[model samples]
Target: MLDIKLIRENSEIVRDSLRKRGDDEKIQMLEELVGKDQQWRQSLDKANALKAERNKIAKQIAEVKKVGGDASEQIKRSAEIPKEIARLDDETIALKTRVDEILMRLPNILHESVPVGADDSANVEVKKWGKPKEFNFELKSHGELAESLGLADFDRATKVAGAGFNYLKGDLALLDLALMNYAINCMVNKGYTLIEPPFMMRRSAYEGVTDLADFENVMYKIEDEDLYLIATSEHPMAAMFMDEIIDEDKLPLKYVGFSTCFRREIGAHGVDTKGLFRMHQFNKVEQFIFCQPEDSWKYHEELQANTEAMFQALGLPYHVVNVCTGDIGNLAAKKYDIEVWFPRQGKYGEVTSCSNCTDYQARRLNIRTGKHGGDKKSVPHTLNNTAIATSRAMVAILENYQNADGTVTVPEVLRQYMGGKEKLGKV
Candidate 1:
């Protein structure tokens, strides 16, 4: 959530950001919020004035009684004042509720560096790493190659759980674990504490981490319960300090989180439905950080560098894009997507997202930082990046490393985790 003070003081900045995002509806919502907020302030002032008047009337009533004069008129007027005050109080509460509702739904302000565009097509490529490998023979899709090598059972997975699911068998299952282990070790070596967050979170806490639209579009809710399966480890890790204040000395709290995420993928369509590229369940290693506001942009680049190094070690060809305003979504002020080369698709697919959310999540979660036992406090900035989404990484690996002989050469970094096996072949 944006700071209401910022919105009130520099509304044109917010308006310009929404315009860049092409979000006219929210522009109108902002106007509504401003009007309602002004009304709420006015109503509160009236209520406070009435309260002061009532106090004065009470004093007058007591003075009249002390002098042995009739106090009936003063007492009667004081009683009537309370009824008016109560009515104004109710109006003030109602307006506040409306303002807060709109505030919660507003997108975070965009950073000046973000590209102005309508969608992903306008995203600017910032960097490219490694080269896309050339294949002499026709390449098979990751799904087909995995099945031909007896490394996965998509047919059975589909029969049991419908589409958008899969079962890894033999060496392929080991590869998945290897990916997670490799990512965890890489992040840990970089001074990020490893954490395995809860796979589920309550709606209230979830709201603090992501846009509420995810409730219907992305999240999987538990039946008859207030819990929702987390869409990413970032959600739980970010919410860990919700409604709490951290000491300023711990300004930079970094964590590498691991979790099996669940998503509904509602309205998703295309060839990815038949493969691991898009799945309902997947394991991910996430990098999350909480730091002072001034340092967030620096940490954002650092997070991107960490993911780039991992991909380089795994020998995956990829490129980074500075996400455009429209594609950056509601949470992050600015974002970068790491798109890995897929030989079969003849293109790059997003395997990681690095974002600097600034103080958006902190404000929504009510997380703050202050001196130990001190009264002063301010919201800290939050950031998250995908170290590896194992499923997509595996897709990239399978397509890029497939040999003409139907074997998949294991990336050198993952070989140790896969029992020193150099290649994965038919079971």
Candidate 2:
């Protein structure tokens, strides 16, 4: 959410930022908020004036009574003032609430460095790592290779659960665990504390981290509970410090969260539905950082670099793209997406995303840091990036490391985690 003070003082600046988002409705809502804010200020001023008048009249009544003069007129005037003040108070409160709701709906201001574009097509590739390996033979998709090897069973999973779910048998399950452990260790070595948060969260807490529309499309709500299964570890980790004020000395708090993410994956019917690429439930290692506002952009790069290093160690060819403003979404001021080359698809697919929200979420969550003593507080910047999503990484590994003989070579860095196994073949 934007600071109301910013919207009030620099509305043109805010409007220009909203225009960049390509959201017409939100721009109109912002205009409405401005009018409502003006009315709220007027109402509050009137209420204050009435209260002041009441206080003055009460003093007059006391003075007139002390001198044995008629004080009934002063008393009646004071009584009438309270009723008017009450009505104005109610009006101000309603207007203020509406203004706050609109502010929360508004997207964050984009950083100047972010690419101005209508969509991902305008995103610029900033860096590329490793080259796609040339294959003499035709490559099969990860789904076909995994099913043939008995590593993943989609038919049985569909029977037990539904479409978009899979059961990993034997080595494939172990590989998932190994990938998670490898990513977790890599982040921990980089000085990030690992946290395992609850898999479910309440609606109130989740609202603090995301837009209202996500509640229906992205999240899975429990049948009879206030909890909804988490879509990413980032959600829980970001909400942990809701309404909190940290010390300034702890300017940068880094965390590596591991969790089983659940998503409805609604509207994704036939796209990568049978593969590990797009599943309803998957394990992921995510990186989250809370730092001073001025340092978030720097930390954003650091987070992206951390994800790239993990990909490099796994020997996956990938490239980093500076996400365009229209594709950046509501939470992040700027974003970078790392798209890994999928040999079978003959193109790059998004594997990890890094974003710097830059106090956008902190303002909504009321996460702040004390400036000095306990007197003043300021919102801290929040960022999150994918360290490794096991499902997609597995897809990359299955396709990129596949041999002509139908064996998949494990990345050297993850071999130790795989019990010294060098290759995965038909068991």
Candidate 3:
């Protein structure tokens, strides 16, 4: 959530940001709601003054009655004040609720560094690594190669759980674990703490971490419970410090979270329905950080650098894009995505995203820091990235490393994780 004070002081700047992002419909409503907020505050001030007057009269009436002096008229009028105050309080609460609703829909102000663009085409390709391999014969997609090697079982998976679900069998299952463990180790070596957090989070906590639209359709809410399955390890990791204060010395806290994340994937009705290109559940080693406002940008770079390092180690072809303003959604002030090459798909697709959400999430989650009543204190900034999401990585590995005869070569970094196997051949 944006700071209410910032909204009040810079309404025009906020409105302009919304307009630039093509969120024109929300501009007028923001203005009207802010006006109501101002009126509500004014009425609250008046109500306080009136309550003080009533209290004074009540005290005077009590003394008058004790002395056997007449106090009936003052007492009768003073009794009406409570009802009026109650009415004002109700109005104040209603207006405050409306104000909060508008604020939730408001997007964060774009970082000056974010490139101005409408969609993916405008995203700046900031980096590239490795080259797509050449094949002596036609390369098969990962889904086909894995099926032949008895490494993945999509047919059985669909029969039991429907599409977008799969079973990683034999070496494939081992590879998934190896990749996540290796990613976490890399993060740990860089001074990050490794953590395995809850796979489920309360809906209220989900709201603090994600956009409102995702709550109803993208999340899998447990019936009769306030909790929902996590869409990413980042969700639980980010929520860890809710309503808590950290010491200033702990600024720039970093952690690597591991989990098998679940997602509804409602928007992907029939797309990539065949393979690991998209899946309902997959293992992930996520990077999450909380830091001082001044350090968030630096950490964003560090996080992206870490992701690129992983891709480089895997020896996969990939490119990095600076997500444009419209493509960033509302959460991030600035975001970057790394798209690993998928040979079968014939183009790059996002395998990882690193974003600097600034104080937007921290404000909502109440993640604050610094010395007790110290000058340097406020809600800390938040950042998260896909250190590695197994599903997409699986797609890249299978399609790019496939042999013409239908064997799949494992990447060198994952060789030990695969028990030193050089290739997975036909079953």
On lDDT, the candidate that comes out on top is 1
What is the overall TM-score of model 2 with all chains considered together? 0.94
| Pairs of residues clashing in candidate 1 | none
Q: What is the TM-score of each candidate against the true structure?
A: 0.95, 0.94, 0.94
Which candidate, 1 or 3, would have the higher lDDT against the true structure?
1
* Superior by TM-score: candidate 1 or candidate 2: 1
Report, for every candidate in turn, its global Cα lDDT versus the true structure. 0.93, 0.91, 0.85
lDDT of 1 at 67: 93
Tell me the spans in candidate 3 whose CA falls farther than 4 Å from its real position: 58-74, 269-273, 373-376, 425-427
Q: Judged by lDDT against the true structure, how good is candidate 3?
A: 0.85
Task: Give the top-scoring candidate (TM-score).
Answer: 1
User: Number of backbone collisions per candidate, in order?
Assistant: 0, 0, 0
> How would the candidate models be sorted by lDDT, starting from the highest?
1, 2, 3
Q: Write the per-residue lDDT of candidate 1 for residues 196-302, one digit (tens) a residue.
A: 99999999999999999999989999999999999999999999999999999987999999999998883464654357888899999999999999999999999
User: At residue 213, what lDDT does model 3 achieve?
Assistant: 90
lDDT of 3 by residue, 132-179 (tens): 876667656677677878888988999999887888987788778878
